[model samples]
Target: MTLDLSALPPRRGRLAARPPAVPPGPPGAPGLRRLGLDPERDGLVLLPDGPGPFPLVVMLHGAGGVADGAVRLIAAAAERHGAAILAPESRDPRSWDLVRGGRCGPDVAFLDRALAATFAWLPVRAERIALAGFSDGGSYALSLGLANGDLFAAVLAFSPGFVAPPDYVGSPLVVVTHGSEDAVLPVTSCGRRVAASLDHAGYRLAYHEFAGGHVVPPDLADAALAAFLAD
Candidate 1:
């Protein structure tokens, strides 16, 4: 299933663009920078140091979270793996579109644009692109990643609240982690339930339940990235 942006229907949850060839220019400078795509709610991309065709992880923030915090969650692990990070701000102030309104639209479109810009600016490994998030962002990652599995090779959802894909495409590797004592989105009703649903739907799943609150611990973050980047 190849991605052709022009051939895609006007579906709310579908992503029609593939990783494009890196344009001719000086190598993209490493470290974080604003995407500058949007004036009010812009996104951030953290470029990896050294070399070409680095792995890219599209990180999504939790409810009422911003790009900085989202990137921070995986920054160290991403650096260790030499992976680029693209963290986009939601169009809505509080949370992602799909999580809040039960439909994916503006956020998907904005993400597409952000990804396109990233591809144009840096050399990204097409097969190493992954979608990841925390809490509400985790839920959105599952929804969008499944819908556009051809574009994302893996989905790392930490403490996801639910899974509601507009449509399932390719079968990407899935890793779901949840805190046992999470009060915001409980493990039983949210993360475990999500993992079960995906397993029942025949997705390749790796579920981890930790003893803590609604947070992505450093060890889990490292392990998740290792799994996603594993050959």
Candidate 2:
């Protein structure tokens, strides 16, 4: 069944203009088993954890390109939330095709494959699945979430860099969190501007700017994420 975005809880900032979620095809449907893309070659799996039959989150790395630090953090977060996690390695250092000016190549096609592969490989619920990233990864999440609206439940970007606005979907849930004093990918350059653009675009967004800089504060991340993900 198509989901009613209005049924979801209210978030901070403007209401999201989300496209209706595309319902799952069918049990063991061929469409469900294949997105017919590839990620194993260019994408890397970090740490995997969480309970069975839960929502899956595909974590893309920042400019650092799948650093061990990010892998550990995302693994821990997935374990804590009981959500399955998949972290794909960037082809280049701290890059996700946004900087290199390559379209329909590895970076763009990577997500398409990763989503299909994860959906087929994991035993999680599709409706609850999400895409999340930090920095460049955050930008990718926004891109993928908007482009593949029917595939993701939510899009979370932490200190994201430049992002191209997506055509308005119905009540899309967008979460942008950034520290007020970030030197790397400054809040002003990343989160704030994106939030404003999303606001203007009519997306349901939760824009959070904490006092700190560039890092996801544990307390704030937990609280805000909880509220953001709550049904």
**Winner by TM-score:** 1
- In angstroms, the error of model 1 at 50 is 0.6
lDDT of each: 0.89, 0.60
79-147, model 1: which lDDT tens digit per residue?
998888999999998999998888888888888878877787777889999999999999999999999
TM-score, candidate number 2? 0.73
Q: Write down the lDDT that model 1 would get.
A: 0.89
What's the C-alpha lDDT at position 231 in model 2?
41
Expressed as tens digits, the lDDT of each residue in 1-231 for candidate 2 is 733433444221112332124433322311112222334334434323433455666667777665344455455555566665666665566477554563324454445445445544456665666677887778877866666555567787878886663343445578888888899888876788999988887877888898987776666545534644574
TM-score, every prediction: 0.93, 0.73
Residue pair clashes in candidate 1 = none
